[model samples]
Target: MATQTPREAPAQAGRRLDLSAPWWSSPRWQEEKRRIRGELAALEARITPRRRLRAVIRTLARHGLLRLMQDRRAAAPSAGDASHGRHPHRDPDRRLRQIGRRLRLAFQELGPAFIKLGQVLVTRQELLPDPITAELAQLLDRVPPMPFPYLAVVLDEELPDGLQTFAWIDPEPIGSASLAQVYRAQLRDGRRCAVKVIRPLVDKLFQTDIANIARLARRLQRLLPPAVAASSDLPGLIRDYYSSVQSELDMRIEARNTREGRELVEEFGTLAVPEVYLATRRVLVTEYVDGWNIKDFPVDFFTFEERFERMIDLAHLYIKEFLNGRYHADPHGSNLIVWRHSKKVYVIDWGMVGRMDALHTEAIFRHLLHIRLNQAEDAAEVMLDVFEPTPYTDVGRLKDQLRSLYIRYVDTEQAGPHNWGHLLVEEIRIAMDNHCRIPTGLSLWAKGWSAAEGTARWLCPEISYHTVVESADVQILRRLLARRFNYRANAAWIAEASELVATLPRRLNKILERAAWNDFKLPVEGRLSEQATRNLNRMVNRATLGLISGSFFLGSALLAALGGGALDRIPGLAAVTTTALWGSLGVGVYTVWRVLRSNKA
Candidate 1:
């Protein structure tokens, strides 16, 4: 990402063997993306609501994705739009692949927000078909770069000293993708740095697009069946991801991420992070990490053994850093480099970062470690302790599901560095299934692992990710255990404990005195809450009804037994008996129905 190289061909273009290549390169997709760029209506937004809606439908149709909207068993809505849907494609893989291609095309056509959505979908790999992830791969990085002139205007406006702040700046971008463009420059003091400028007006664009996306997600939530809606809380997922995307829009946040990373790596000899020089809402100035992008780093520079060592070192470095509560969320090849001379790894582009509190990070480690030790139930307990279950969350079901995952993990062959990334993803899927709103920190943690593990794979395909992490686990645990014994870390806890001990005897004596005086009574919650009151009133009403019915029966039976004691006052005792019996039966049936309905509600 810190090189002078121009953007390369789209990864899809070079993937001839990809199941998605045909749809990706199709003229239809190109036209769909370019066609129908509607201007926003003047009324309260950056995009016209109606045009955006139609454009979505049209794009979905063009890509044969409208079928997703229509009832699956029903006939296609339009022959042109649902051409592929009719096939039913007896081969499930082909059907999924086709759906994946169409969905990717539809997302691309919908613009930046949807493309970003596809990127999120790929991250939940366990929840998606491989075809889907493969087709929608690396979308965040694939957002087309904006023209340099516009970005330069942003730079001049956002920088305190204007263009004169930099001794010289190469207008040509060293890297550009997602939300910003990177230009190489030298500060007034002659320290070479990278100037990252947010793409002009992207803030407004993302704002408008995300608003529309939320609208769509809401509609999907309502329109989809209960089972489908529960399986994927579209609105909830969009909200979580968009919150992070919104954070990414502000360059100051990215600068802060860089600053935090810089601090963590200061003590790491093998790892380096760019130092932040200056930051603004729209611009970031940081030390220019001089190295070849990891993917393109020359093969001749290191021996296989050295490459393996660096890979292990990189993995270990992130493990420690993440446990400390900050991680580079997108450590892909482009955001990483190998220093030309020092041979150390340079982590660049700290824009997309994930952070967790110490407790959560410790929980994640404990969860994984339990799994490593083959204590499936303990691992489940560790995670369940952290998961925040929802109204729909079945704790028992969640337990069963988590245990099943453990079983699968045990049965499956281990591949790809012990597959911690895989486990994180599975947890996410399980969380979603049970309506557990896991902290964003966990999502970011998983993202960090996925990207880091992937970059490790790219550097040394034979690298042992699990083995590296096993050693890392020992070190990580050691550091945590040592922190517990640190006086500084436990000062507040020790103070609290001391106070509690000092007050113990006094508190106990007061309790005993009150007990002897018959003044110490357990405070029990009264069964007089609003709901409890309502239930009591309903019971009283039912009892009164029964009392009235019994009185009527007794009166009628006495009258009949006395044989018209009132001397012709009651001529139809049989009719009276039948009416009372039927009426009482009706009342009892109604009461029973009411009780059942109330329980259901």
Candidate 2:
């Protein structure tokens, strides 16, 4: 076929070019192209089949599930197998212990991702079985340090010119973990610092393993019981894990977190945060703080009173951070150090932090206020407002549990020297059991508080966390009231003075007009007659009863009318509506009979 050239096309237009649309411009073709492109993009984004298969295989092998299956099959009863008659699984205690041991080993073998998962699982004792959670609690992140040459290569890549700034860098690592290794180094300017280098390939491995774990978690959520699923949001857990891993992988982010934490708690002269010298995506250099881990610090160094005072100070600091909406999410004993000579507490490893919204902060403040006032019911109500309730939540049960927990911990007449951190943990567990979702920030705060409390307790067994919190509450209340009073003294005085000045003329005119009309008089009062008072009390009682009955009746009717929607879907709405209706009828009958009896009398 012969085609017309561009220059000749115009001249050939006289022959009438075909008016058909091009294929690419056709609507049908465009739609098909978009659909194909979408499909290809989705396929590319999804986990590859080979990668999925490999993950599954690795999981099964590392967890010993395949070996367990083999053992079960080999132990299965056969015609010639007489020993099969004995049921080894009859003792669930023994079987559970064996499973826990195997699971611990499996997590260790699976490396960092699984180890981190296990560490997280340890805090979910409410959702997981006790044995499993207990075993997972023992999972540690300690690992053999990578070679100095490899770490040097990473430092060189991260800071090519700046690497020379260090005069002496120790080849031996002081500590090593799944993600990073730390070494003591001296700068050319003679400043001693700790250099942390992220392990090569850790980020990539974490991405792959996290993806597989997330997929597995989704499947597990579907297969688990309703209570388990409600208690443990696997999807949310995976998301939080991803966030924490991303933060830890970026040394710059950690450095920022450290700086912010230092700024937040700098008011407390006894507390310290390491100063960051150099920060990069994979390398962090911070001032090397020489101190004893809070866990291992000798208690005899400080007197009992000094230890108690320090504990109270530490508790106050944590409470202040919580109120300010910035909290250290991980304040474990290892991350806390007590300086030997200065006797100051230093917080390290600021890889994970949490923030609270204004609403959450105010709610928590009110909750603590109620606790301090010994209003357990009010405290429970405030706490309920802080957490999100699920469709299956038993609000009454949750409230009751919270009230009881507060009474047990905060009510001094009922208990002595209670641990506030332990109480918070128990409260969270209760919330979980009742299908309430605690905010992530609040959960982290509670966990950090618990760890801090543990360290304090270890230092002084006689220290009481509840007492410390109560003291802090008093101080905070005083500060808040003082600030409020100061504001009112400055701002409210001007408004009040202006209002008085505006009303003074009107008041004077009214008084002068009344005097001119001779309407001003002093009034005298006589005691009310008994009959009039009785009538008034009767009317008030009737009106009060009527209002109460009306409210209940209206509420019940609304619930019944809306039963097809939200009311019907709720687990116990019907019972509540029925109770309201019956109670209203009972009250109405009692009111009517009382009026009749009074009239006859």
Candidate 3:
């Protein structure tokens, strides 16, 4: 046989982008510049008149290379070449979705702030294309960290007299993103923690780039095609882009958010929060969690199914607890840590917590049940309320449109599997384009839940969406009900109730005096409308009644579910409980039915 030689496989692609060495010092910068220039040149011919103008401005603004780069068009492929023209579009909607995906991919390749922006965009699903939103939701901040030397410089500047002050510092970082890098280290007292240090001089350049992007967003808000513009949230959407960028620059906020999240999740068993250590302007130190990434947990440690189920269960619990009270807010895979010893989830990094009020949280459960039951109209109403449309807007018409949109989205996905996160985003985007704005809390809640849902589905295919939804709905609602009951009994409520009681005696005295004088004819109020007086009294009655009713029902339910031997009080109450299980099933069935009807035509 003839002698043959085998070619070696290429080195891991990641090895090419090592961050241990300073990025600017790497000769790779030249290669990247060349690559970008080449891409820009190729992109030039495909650009429309306006987009070409944008391209030119962007190119100049990015590199200050005013002179048109070498035009290799003469040597390049003609328009007939596959690389020279746009991809064939059999379906325009698909093409639009592809555009969104491509844009997100571009941001991913750009690294850090852009990747963070993409992460934020996915969370703001109501303001972006469904396909785009879905794709962006997959964004992970996996950029290489700055060289240790540069990081050392940052620490030195921020710490005043440094290194000698600390007992031990790891030269390598555990996790790195576009904005900040986290390293494992120990204090002089031998306490183990991770120090997250921001990049040096990243703010000025990043802010400038962001300001330019903001201006571009404004211009595009006015210029995109009707369908395209309608598909995006634009200006309002990018408002937080700047805020997030500014936030990443300060580590103090992260310290505070993490501390608060720890306290919030502390009450829950099987869930833990990382403890924050010393926090300075540029660095935040927190207890190092000895846990595995939920998704990447070793199969040897647990079966595939076990891994998946645990992740899903963790997500369900965390989300319920979060929406019920405060949330870790951002529950991306990176933030999820599976503690091996206790088999609990330790969520870290809480810079972007979302607040859900009573009304919004309740509406979310209603929406979830609606989805589980597939009741289209009820779902639509909840969507409208969540979006908070204007009175002048034709909700009926919008509902019809939303129903069609939902059908299209559901139909487009394989096997008719719908992602709630993407669906919510689409619904929100539609509302925003039509002058509706969903509360930030609701949007974040949707994002967090969608992430949990997606992770759960990925972990356990046998875990039915309906079951997950129902379980979460029950727990969240129960917790919220408890909180409401507690609030009604709070000192504030006591004071208000006392004042109302005190007023009752004076009002009674007036009534008695009037009756005694036989001048019982009540003076008609002229300033206030009868309708206003009636409404106010009705509200007061409802508040008082609601407090009493909710507390009683909640207590009864708790006693029935958990109080040992309490069920034996009534004659054949066990049999009644057995029968009542059927009633509960019927309610669930009806709830799902309502959701389907409301969500569809």
Candidate 4:
């Protein structure tokens, strides 16, 4: 009856007419679904080409900017170039000044990333030629400050209350760098602080630039000569560059570094680090330090004694941190300041710090010790242990070079301002030339030392880095010895003692047997005691007599045994035997008397 009215099926009620499985569960439908996913993935993969194209364009733009700046420099010839034509006899100082000025201008125009690159280049004399490195050293944190509106926005985002959190913030920044700018601010609590604000979009821009540079570096590595590529370590350098810049971008890391550094150097009493107030991914707030930056201070500001004392304190700070295995990686003049009132030196900007493991620290300590003792061979060995040698390295040649370095820089009879920093830099270069891989941290440490030395020399040219190192070594040794004796003997000492005790019996037995065989020899020096001399003489006489008596006895016994031979027929045989026996007896009695007399005495 329902079939008669087909429309009355009630639209198939609640269930479908065909009760098939879901499409996704069907094998054919699943295969089609996978094909769609594969198509989507292929489309996603196509986006990479667009991204690569964008990267290429950005790289080309950077190259164009560099080329434009270089062309401008070439167009504007120096006075020497204009006058001399083919071979200009230019004053070296003037030429360097011109180059430095041009380089600084170009870096400034190329923007923050290039400026940072230039700053890093200043510390890498091994990677760049001297002129280029010297020119790059002029690069400073003189970037144009971000507009107050944008900075306020950043502040608002970082601190929920925005600029209202501070009583007053200087619109004009005190210092401006590539990634961040520092402004003087007073908190609502009336605490003066330095506010460091990371520039907007710097992270994204740096990421893009660094990626392009890394890709370019890889390409260049393939094109470069084998020796040049090996020596440059382009990949490693790029990686380190990326890591350091990224770390700098994260202000929280710098804050942590600052706190750790403060704790590490707090024992010096004369050294201090600014107290951190707030730290975030892009912002850092620290106690406002009012002091003269070492770079800006006049040489005459401090008296000779004051400068010398400061030098000593500075040296101690660096040496202690180095020996402790954590050191400020960048101790340039701008990063250091001297408080006029307290005379305390404040180290600021703990962005780039270095760390050495215990083994590295111990190796460095040993190296310093060897240098102090003028043990070139030991120093060379320490260096070898620290550096990874390549197959092409000639260890003997490396040692000879190190010996020469020690003699020239460390072994001079007269104490002078020997730049240990420069010496270390040279050592790194030598190791590189020898195909030895010097730790990058060591290079950074050496750069810091060089910068410190330069700053010290600027303040007082007469200050001797070598003297500071020697004095530091003495202090370190004294402290080490004190610590060593402060505690009771450790398990190591106990173990050594136990070993000695265990072997004592064997050693004593060997000595006694040697003495019994008369094979023992005593090493003597200086003066001999009267009893000792007398005993030695008596023992010699007894030994002689004993030998003679033993020979006589043996001869007599042989003659007696051979009585049936020709000698038995001789009439004097009995007399000879009797004489030998009487002589032997007499000698034996005399020997015994001498022994008894010596014992009585």
Model 3 Cα lDDT, one tens digit per residue, 1-601: 0111001101221222222234423455435445544654564445344553465366444542232222222223455655423644434346445555565556654445567777776676655556766666656554655666556556644764454335556666687776778877777677878888887555644555566677778998899744345435577667756775676578888888777776766656657788887778888878888888767766577666665556546656666655655665667677778777876778877766666776676676676556556577777777776666653345677888777665544322211356565666666666765655467556777677666666665555565554555556666767767766876658778899899998999999999999999989855633444467766776566456545545545555565688658677667766665555555555545545644664631
Consecutive 10-residue window with the lowest summed lDDT within model 4: 1-10
Worst 10 residues of 2 by lDDT: 1-10
RMSD, candidate 4, Å: 28.4
Give the distance in Å from residue 115's predicted Cα in candidate 3 to where it truly belongs: 4.1
Q: Give the alpha carbon lDDT tens digit for every residue of 499-589 in model 4.
A: 9999999999999999999999998645444467777877887899889997997787777677656466787878888789778878888
lDDT against the true structure, each candidate: 0.71, 0.71, 0.62, 0.71
Give TM per candidate. Answer: 0.66, 0.64, 0.59, 0.64
Q: Report lDDT (Cα) of residue 285, candidate 2.
A: 93
Estimate the lDDT of model 1. Answer: 0.71
Q: For every candidate structure, what is the RMSD over all alpha carbons to the true structure, in angstroms?
A: 12.6, 21.6, 25.9, 28.4
Model 2 alpha-carbon drift over 4 Å, by segment: 1-56, 65-100, 129-131, 224-232, 411-418, 478-601
lDDT preference between candidates 1 and 2, better one:
2
C-alpha lDDT of residue 571 in model 1: 62
